[model samples]
Target: MKTVLIAGFNGSMGQQAVKLVNSMEGFAITAGLAHHLPDSDPTSYGLPASTQLFTSLNEIPAGIADIWLDFTVPTAVYANVKYALTHGYRPVVGTTGLTDDQEVELKKLTQDNHLGGLIASNFGMSAVLLMKFAQEAAKYFPDVEIIEMHHEDKKDAPSGTALNTAKLISKNRPAHQTAPDETESLAGSRGGDYEGIKLHAVRLPGYVAHEQVLFGGAGEALTIRQDSFDRKSFMSGVKVALEQVHTLDQLVVGLEQIL
Candidate 1:
């Protein structure tokens, strides 16, 4: 069985990962690391009696687990992933907010160490498919815009899925593709612009993670959308990453590669 460590084990996504790994075979959780945990026993989250939980990464001993599954927030993600790599733990990161430069550096470090790591923006299968679909559609429709909606509690604006979609579609489109001339009376009404595509973000209650890619042509428009109504939607992708990360020779940044 492969040993596992969970980061952010108390959050909704973390809890889901915890439950999933517990139910699956050929995997075992050795420890869980959260910012803090309430006064309770480990089994409360279905952890085995041998498993432990910690609030700080430093508190854990080295070589405690073979790999780490990170569901932490963006601000803390860089340091957490670096710690895992430096300490010889392969990491499967579902955290968002890593910049392009951070990704490049992480890949180099993983290669240098002769290890494997996975950093994914969205772990929902439909979301990954949406990104691929948008890239394919961009070859035909050059003018596109994106709108992403997530729960208000999500800290990052312009969800990682949306950013990845824009980047993929941007690469397929020609340079200097222009949108129609328009005027915005309000300062931020047009949303953020990446390449030539407009991106809008929405945060509200009662939403999990959702995105829509709208492509406009002369007389018709095509919209490709995906909705994740629950946190469990991502568990499958996380499981896939965990099972497949060790097979890589370097860091991977998207779930689409494994799928």
Candidate 2:
């Protein structure tokens, strides 16, 4: 059985991870880490009595788990993942807030330690396909813009998925201005820019997770969209990552790499 340690165990996504791990056959929840909480009793959090609970990274015992499932906040995710990598736990990260430089540094650490890990921006299969489809469409339709929507509680702007989509689109689309002389009547109205592509972020109470890629051609336009109606949609991809992460030679970014 693969023993799993879930970080951010009190958060919404973390609770979902707990359910997923419990429901899976070969995986077991060995421990949980949630720094924001004062209570360390596993039973108080509705976890199994046998599952160990920790309030901080320093308190987690080594060799307690084989996999580190992270759904922590943006501010804590980088440090959490770093600790997992160095301390012999393979990571399957879903928390998004890591900068480009931080990813580079973690990739090197994984290589040096000879550990396998994955950092996925979005685990929903539809979202992954949207990014893949967006990259392909960018070859034919270079003039494109992206809009991503999430819950109000999401911490980061221009979410990791949106940023990854932009990077993928940039690879196929040349760097050129979409509207050279266009001026906004109101300041910052056209959304954030990434290599000439406009990216708009929306956070609202009703939205789950959604994204749209709009492309304009000579006389026609194309729009590709994907939505996650429930957080459970992401668990399937997380299951795949857990089963296959140990096969990877080094840490990699994006679910597409594994897919």
Candidate 3:
């Protein structure tokens, strides 16, 4: 059985991971580290009684865990992942908002240590497919725009998913030389620019996670979209990373590799 330690197990996505781990065989949650627990117990989120819960990473036993599942926020993801890698523990990060420099450092650290780590902005399978589809469509399109929607509680706007999609599509863009705009329109109508692609971010209370990429050519448009209806939808991606962590000892930026 693979022993997994869940970091930030009290969060929304963390709770989902908790459910998924419990449902699977040949895997067990060794322990969980939550910044703080709810009034009741961790088992309220379906964590097994066999799983120990701690408030801080400092309390975790060294080398006991095969991997650390990070479902925490971006604000704390970097430090948590670093701690896991430094101690020879693999990490699967579902948190978004890690900076480019942080990612570079993360890959370097993982490679130097010969340890595996998986980080993805969105672990929903459709989300990965949407990214891939957008990238493919980019090869033929001249303009692209992205729209991402998430829960209001998500701190980062223009979610990592939208930005990453833009980056991917921009890489294969036509060489027609369209300058990335510097225009100020309707105050915030242009959204944020990732390379030459325009990105729009939306936050609402009822949304789980949703994104779409619109590619416009001379007279036609193609849109690829994906939605995570519930937190449980992310379980497949998490499970895939957990299943593949041993085989890949390098940092994987997305779920495309495992799929």
Candidate 4:
């Protein structure tokens, strides 16, 4: 059985990971780590009785778990991954916000340690396909924009999926989009720009995670959309990453790599 440790165990995604892992065979949650209630008992925080819990990676004992599944906040993700690597545990990170430089350093660290590490922006299978489709579409239609919607509780803007989509689309496109030289009465009406692709983010109570990539051409416009209506949509990808991570020699970014 693959022993797993879940960081950010109290968060929605972490709790969902616990449930999914327990439902499957050949895997066990060795322990959990959270960002809150450091002085109190972790068991009281609603976890499986067999799983131990801690408030920080510093408190986790070495060799207690093989893989650390992280769904923590952006500010803490780098520290969590570094600690996991230091403690000799492979990491499957779903938390975003690590810059390109940080990823380069983490890749080197994983290579030196000969450990499998994953940093994925989105874990839904449809989302992965959506990005692939967006990349393919960008070759034909260089004018594109992204609209990403998530729950209000989500801390990050533009969602990692949108960012990844923008990056992928920008990479495959042949030329920069034609600039619209129109004046805007609103300062932020055009949305954020990344490689000339406009990105818009929306946060609402009813949304889980959704992204729509709109591509414009001469006469026709194409829209590629993916919706993650439930948190469970991400668990299958997480399981896939967990199962395949140990075989990797270095850090891999994007779930598409493993898929």
- Between candidates 2 and 3, the lDDT winner: 2
The lDDT of model 4 is 0.88
Per-prediction TM-score = 0.95, 0.96, 0.93, 0.95
**What's the distance in Å from true for residue 94, model 3?**
0.6
Ranking by lDDT: 2, 1, 4, 3
The top-ranked prediction according to lDDT is: 2
In model 3, state the lDDT of residue 133: 87
Worst 10 residues of 4 by lDDT: 37-46
For all predictions, the C-alpha RMSD in Å is 1.4, 1.3, 1.8, 1.7
Those runs of model 4 whose alpha carbons end farther than 4 Å from true positions after fitting are 38-46
When summed lDDT is taken over every stretch of 10 residues in candidate 2, the lowest stretch is: 174-183
**Per-residue lDDT value at 25 in model 2:** 93
Sorted by TM-score (best first), the order is 2, 1, 4, 3
Candidate 1, poorest ten consecutive residues by summed lDDT: 173-182
**Where does model 1 exceed 4 Å of error?**
180-183
**Residue 181 CA error for candidate 3 (Å)?**
6.2
Summarize candidate 3's per-residue lDDT along 29-105 as a digit string, tens digits: 87888887764365676787767888777887777779899988778888999889888889999988899899999
Q: Give the per-residue lDDT digits (tens) of candidate 2, residues 1-259.
A: 9999999889888888888888889888989998777776787766778998888899998899999999999999999999999999999999999998999999999999899999999999999999999999998899999999999999998998999999999999865545787778998889998888899999999999999999998899999999999999999999999999989889989998998
Q: Assess the local accuracy of residue 166 in candidate 2 as a C-alpha lDDT between 0 and 100.
A: 96
Q: With candidate 3 superimposed using the best TM-score fit, by how many Å does residue 130's alpha carbon deviate from the native?
A: 0.7
Q: Give the per-residue lDDT of model 1 (tens digit) for 196-253.
A: 7899999999999999999988899999999999999899998899999889889988
